[model samples]
Target: MFLGYHILTKFFKNGELSNDSPKESYLYYEKNAIDGDLQGIIQKLDYLKELGIDLIYLGPIFKSKTTHGYDITNYFSISENISSNSEEEAKAIFAKLIENAHKRGIKVIIDLVLNHASKEFDFDSVPKNLSVKTESPRSPQEERWQMSFLFWNLDDEDTREFLIRVGEYWLKNFELDGFRLDHALGLPLNFLEEFSIRMKKIKKDVTILGEVWEDEGDKLKNFNLLKKFKGNDAQRFTSMFDFATYDTIKEVLGKKNGSLLELYNQIVLSNQLNEKEFQLTYFIENHDLPRFIDICQDIETFYITLGLLMALTGNVMLEYGNEIALKGDQTIHNFHESGRVAMKFKEDWSEQEKKTFNYCKNLVDLRKVHSSLSSGSYELINSEENLLIFKKKTTYDEIKVLIYTGEQAYQLDKEYFDLISNNKVLKLKRGIYYLQ
Candidate 1:
């Protein structure tokens, strides 16, 4: 069952508040963008609602030194860059933003970097030996050094209590729906279990999404690691970002002579391994990865790849401006600065961009209307050299998705309604086709 399903149903009558929308998608916003402030984001709630977005994963709003907001100095205070006023005023603005978003039926999940903090964080109570010096290799010539930033000594009772308090304070005070835990794999399993337990206690319907960018087989590896942290126990995290799926999609869609069979195998394997109740957050591009448009080289391939992502069984997440073909590449020197550029709106868009946006909006709408596309069992109908066909079926509905990456158009045997065009399509072309 989806987390917060019952509570959301009880609160909202129209079934819009539930997180189980097949179109449940996320948009990652950077704080430094042109219209990235809390007020600016509130002003654009209608844009997101119109795009069929169900959730907004705002990048860290806490006090931080870097533009990315990962190196947080104060977890309790909102960043001065995101809010130029007093801390209390900033909190008020954020609360108002949340109020507006909830009113529009869009959930908000803020980023929480629990693995590490900035060197400037006050750590006087913790022992000096707990501090660790770390360096991130930027390039062949340079490295960024981080000194005395503690990853929170999990063994210490005081540290765990403080962190739990932080989690509870935000959930209770801000009325937040959930949190996106950054670098979650780096944190100890014990800390995760306890943190999740405590946070859920405060708000039972609150969701927790962890950043676990390892192979699908690493769930067993994580299980083993948790055993080492303590004895055998159940995994507590609700879901994690599916990096394995992202990598397979990139390999097939981004490269020439990429195999459709390999991509099909990865999709099947991921479904087999993932837990039924725990959904994997799926995305083609994020702040850490290069844009799909930059790697795919052609718009047709990009749209086909996006269609495949939307058809997968999980919570779909799209980085900001991906629908309009925002292009950027992350480098060791610039880090993710290039990938985290400002978002473009209607007046700043081109003809091609508008087309891509409409295509994405159509896909999102199709997902929302069909139950099979959102939460259903998957079955592979056919897998040819350059063409792939699959079906997602629920008891009530079934959706068939076809993808042809070859040069020539492909023909179909039966007539079906094209979800993209909302017209009866008799044959398949050298593009993506969806039938319900």
Candidate 2:
């Protein structure tokens, strides 16, 4: 139910935006989309395929002069900077990519930023021209104390219409499999609710994923910058980035044996939501986080962390370049794009890096094999300062036990197979079993 991947290999950037080539800066690139340099990305498809990743989520690749394509000026076609806008050329490139991926049974999702258009967007009524006024007391935008919760004044009906039109245009023209909405918190809840409904009308199978950041609280409250009191219910987006989980993991990594109870509480909190809204995009470190290997300081912790993500029933995004141990101070715009460091694809990968890569690949494969891991029926088995354990049961009989921690290995109940190597049964309550 949860599809994964973040900031596409084609659209990643580091520091201030620049039109540099990926050669000059690994994450940087000129105006090139999937259609522009087909061979460039075509080569990397195998890596994702090998990882058993059937669903891919790409960041904005629309027409934009910036290295990152968040500032979208066009919606109906691929950015001219990246590819020819001719219908024939666009269709041909799309067909080839779709055919290739279908052969491998992979689905692609593109990021759609609906909250605000680029300053250069062709809209005549720009945010600057619009004036804020309380028209209707109960109007959704008016109900929120501010005329604009995001970039522009939502009070302007004209702006809302333009955004809605953009959504419809892309849905009809591109026939994309789904969308991973950017800044779902800034978007109006009513707008998204309607957009999701309209998308279904256009294509019954179209999926919608929202980039909803978790609010600062132990319990689920209003999403960050979302004002439910003012009728800005941002929770309309189908799924959100797992900021809550990421927050917990970040804390755990920085301090040894810290807040096991908090981690457990967060997981249980996520499980309580509706299944449709229950899924989270989980990751220890993403395009915005420092490298996972660097954060953990060792491969063993990374393996255990990887297991935790796969064992949970949610959509998990593995940053495109993270597999090769790409690292840098990626925070731009005050860490908005945390790990967008330059990449070195030409350099040979380390043996340890490849081993870590395969570990993730195997974990993903294992999740796909076990339905219980996908369909939630999970419970915390044991959680302590140094050891963590959980069980996922699909149909009462089909059960999976996931156990790992920073401490020496602990015992598990008999009948559990070593997920890494399916061999002898496991016994818990024993002495140290060093994780690293």
Sliding window of 10 residues with minimal summed lDDT for model 2: 225-234
Off by over 4 Å in 1: 1-35, 124-150, 214-234, 273-276, 329-335
Q: What lDDT would candidate 1 get against the real structure?
A: 0.68
lDDT of 2: 0.56
Candidates' TM-scores? 0.82, 0.77
Where is model 1 poorest over a 10-residue stretch in terms of lDDT? 3-12
Model 1 lDDT, residue 198, Cα: 92
Backbone clash count for every predicted candidate, in the order shown: 0, 8
Model 1 lDDT per residue over 1-436, tens place? 2211101101111211221212222122333334245666776778888988878887788876555566667878886556544788889878987899899888888888776677677455334444423334322221232442445555666666676677888998997988888767666677888988898888777778777653333334543332343222225666666676677787788765458877877777666544654666677777766668877889988999878877777688888777788766444245345565666778889999999999988888877877777677888889888888888899998988888887876777788887877788876667888786
lDDT of 2 by residue, 135-159 (tens): 3333343244233222544546766
Superposed model 2: Cα runs more than 4 Å off: 11-39, 84-91, 124-150, 214-235, 254-257, 276-278, 329-334, 342-347, 396-402, 406-415, 425-436
